[model samples]
Target: MSSKMQRPVCLLIWLFLLEAQAFEIPINGNSEFAEYSDLVELAPDKLPFVQENGRHQRSLPEESGEETDTVDPVTLYSYKVQSTITSRVATTTIQSKLVNNSPLPQSVVFDVQIPKGAFISNFTMTVNGMTFTSSIKEKTVGRALYSQARAKGKTAGWVRSRTLDMENFNTEVNIPPGAKVQFELHYQEVKWRKLGSYEHKIHLQPGKLAKHLEVNVWIIEPQGMRFLHVPDTFEGHFQGVPVISKGQQKAHVSFKPTVAQQRKCPNCTETAVNGELVVMYDVNREEKAGELEVFNGYFVHFFAPENLDPIPKNILFVIDVSGSMWGIKMKQTVEAMKTILDDLRTDDQFSVVDFNHNVRTWRNDLVSATKTQIADAKRYIEKIQPSGGTNINEALLRAIFILNEASNMGLLNPDSVSLIILVSDGDPTVAAMGEMTAGLDNLSINHFFPYL
Candidate 1:
């Protein structure tokens, strides 16, 4: 091409670039941004670029039903976040990059929902001197932090920005063709009392960011509080997060509780010979009802109610020392066992079975509830460490066998009633109960206990 032709092409490209820059970066002169600057102090590092011309605004794409939910075309984009706890102060920043591809001019507006606990303290442009400070005269929904400060009430929480100004708040940028603008924000959060592990989600209202722009969440717990469990540790991606040691405050983890009884029984009227016996300690109150007692056969039950006399019950523990039950489970179990030992009366007889693939008996024979026997049981329980797969049924059968053998030897008092408490985290793997079994036939008699 001739030099003259090349010069014209170069000039055209430079003009397009200049136009894009002019629209993408704008100077804000508005009250909304001013009001945001008042309550919260602005930091220069956290400010976002303002949209000067219509070129920087994002237009909503029309979606077929197959694409996703419907959205407005001119909503542009917005960043919003709020704190839930009134006692804690929180701030959230939203950032996005807008790109213009169409030839026609476009603009976007962002809407944000402020949580009850927080308020905007500062709003400013990082690159330019566009300042928007909240006017003390303007009324807002929640009691403002500054207002609380003046009243000298517990000045913990703050208010937040409700709406993002499109044309004025520096959100509206004119995008001609193939132009883009980056919007960034930095939010500050302060809390009164350290909030426990909680969640705050931030995302562009559907029409805003690109279809693939993911919602990112970064949770920061109070100094002493720790995250006990999370559905997924990876950031938006399904990967585990690094495990960190917890502080003094314990983390709360949730797990589904096993149902103690089947609320609806298929064979309601039918009775089985091997009656069901539920003997639990530290169990939920609703489980205490002896629905299994209705079987009306030989069944013995013993329960350590929240407040009950610790007498007449002799317990033999068959604990699974498999590889699985370790760490917190083992530690908690041992602590509870110590408490149980303290509750035992001098006359109460007790024995211990520490089983993995095989059994290790604390006592060769059933031991009387003498102080010496109780101490020995405690020591044995303390020494138990998980090491193998759980054979719950095997452990129970062995425990029961030992109890029966003791009864025959005139060691266990048949009238006093005896219990074999099975503690296991895993279900039965090998050795299970046969098709038929008999014992505790008299509902007025003995008890069976199983703790999961």
Candidate 2:
């Protein structure tokens, strides 16, 4: 071989060897050694082998080798979920118990799925009477703590939320043989408005059935409650008909499944819930007041007051066009905006502000949602292309300014609803001056009203 080629080949081989050695080194020297020592101490008798050059050397087994026993994975012992819906806010609590039935110690991964738009406020896990709880913190601070915990082989927490309306909570817990662990998760969600009635749903598909499963729902409404409905598929699953209290102010719904009951179903899977349960309430339109209905242990409340004229609204939609919202996200955003614009009433007025690093308005002022105006707005939304960095503070301030100008010009009525809807997937990455928080506060105090 030529000397030039041989020289480069030798250098490449040396570099590869150096990279391999570097990767084998412990990230934290003391912690790694302690972890290895703890494992050796725990099972010195079971490990019939010796360490040679950092690798285990196992001895050959005898002719009559001892049989090895297998351990079952952790089983969900009990799952109990309860929800309370008042007005448009729903608070849900879930309690789950997991048991390690095998003789060997096990590390179990627990996952829970939450509906989109729900905010998880608290989570707690208890193992052998030792409790670990999680609380909300700034993103940067939370990331730092998570990194530290993972490096030290301690419990690290995270949440994965990618889709529009779904989030998954995943965590790991170690359980000793014959021991049990308990987890409690609490969250809040706002019910979205449908044609007439408001709706809320509880998802129960966790890929495994609990030995004991139960759900309790309570509905409270100061207004009177009307008719309540449950799916026919779950009719045989509930304890009894929903019990509605007199005056229709409260209701309750309960569901409990016995082991024998689930066994009787020929097509029922051992690890899966047979079907999802849905609850619906139809409010009495003639009541002209809010109504509450209770059945069994479930409750539903209708909060739309009657005998009042529909209020006109001035809505400003500030949309994000940053690089991250390039493909599917931008497509979905544009489609949703088109649907919303089409649904606006003739008396309602709206304006669109598409923003990236800079902001562009569809019009100088809010325009009535006439047929022609709606068509023009749809065309404008169709042409919006994703680009640049996120400037949430600037975009929001621009919206507030437009609304304030409208109010000053007497274009907005005192009785009308004025709202600014700011949509963005990323935080502020560009700021012209002051802090982003201060800029947001100024916008809020001026003309931004909070909406679900």
Candidate 3:
């Protein structure tokens, strides 16, 4: 309760921000790779996050390979991003070419942030007239190979860091002076429909200024695209206009900001292109049953109809008032509760269950979402304070009992939807209690999360 539950900082082998910091690969004067743990005890802010496009103006250590004052010694020549989306599945490839403009060997990192759930399929690096490809193998085989490489004095570093919805992959190499390194990374992911639209997001963070940075995307859907729109990124660097070429079944979207356009200001060297490029669109679904497709003996189907009347829902709000959620967290939750309660439909039946060390309820049973009931719920929420321990499983069981009892009394509509929203931030103090409902049969669970 004394400290905030902040997001854990992921380090290299671990590596975003709209927070670009040069994660210096801890390599000594020799070619051998030093343990990343040996890296200077630099805080996230203390790390070189060059406000000048991450190109520090300070003098480099005598052995850091480069000695330049005007530009970063590692100059990015070209960064090309291309992706082909077929039937909502996209495979994107990112390629970049960089040349060490220093007389001494320097450590350079090739970093990219991608969607969290996406899987990296392939990664390759070419430097000094040789190509190296990374492959996945059994742990034992990988360990044996690593042992052999270490014995032969070969060293390389590859690390990845993750946040809520994005992951950053960083590859570091020690390049000889004036040598060029080409990096290629391939990743794949499916753009699943969320809240009725499909979105494809691309993370763009060219740490330093780039001369040639281009992005090309092609979307092909047999069902045909209904709409395609791109919103302004990074405060309308392009004056709120995004050029998109769209057609019935296919579309093309390209973004090529010139070096001058990439700057934060007219003449400033700092970059203003460190954010997500998003594209949202919908596909045609002819029937309420949606579509069913069969490919190579595999089948996938979707059915979510919106033309019918909205089903009344039996909703239960299980909120946590644990000590971990004391100040700002509780205030935000209270604000969100006001909005959520306001969104409840008049026909919906809802109740509030607040728990910490003990379970408490505003009402013994569900109540219709009349104006008076909603106002009462808001008052109850404002009075709830954070203290004691978390008891998640107990709160959930209480919800089930209330809903079931309403059903038994014939107060619940047979066609009504059921939802139990649990807002908690700590682990339960009780043991596994999900199976406490062994008496109930024919139960199914469906999870719905909103992300754009």
Top TM-score prediction, candidate number: 3
Would you list the clashing residue pairs of candidate 3?
A: 13-159, 14-160, 14-161, 15-160, 15-161
- For 171-210, candidate 1 gives per-residue lDDT tens digits of 3334344344344444444332112233432322323323
Off by over 4 Å in 2: 1-72, 83-93, 113-170, 185-200, 218-224, 231-250, 257-276, 282-304, 432-452
How many residue pairs collide in each prediction? Answer: 48, 23, 5
Error of 1 at 311 (Å): 4.4
Deviating ranges (above 4 Å) for candidate 3: 1-70, 103-107, 135-179, 194-196, 285-289, 302-304, 429-434, 437-452
Q: If scored against the real structure, what TM-score would every candidate get?
A: 0.32, 0.59, 0.73
User: lDDT of candidate 3 vs native?
Assistant: 0.69
Q: Pick out the ten consecutive residues of candidate 1 with the lowest summed lDDT.
A: 6-15
Question: In model 3, what is the error at residue 204, expressed in angstroms?
Answer: 1.6
Model 3 error, position 344 (Å)? 2.2
Model 3 over residues 164-283: C-alpha lDDT tens digits? 334768778788775667788888887778888899999887787665677777788889999997877667786643558887887878887767777788777777878888889999
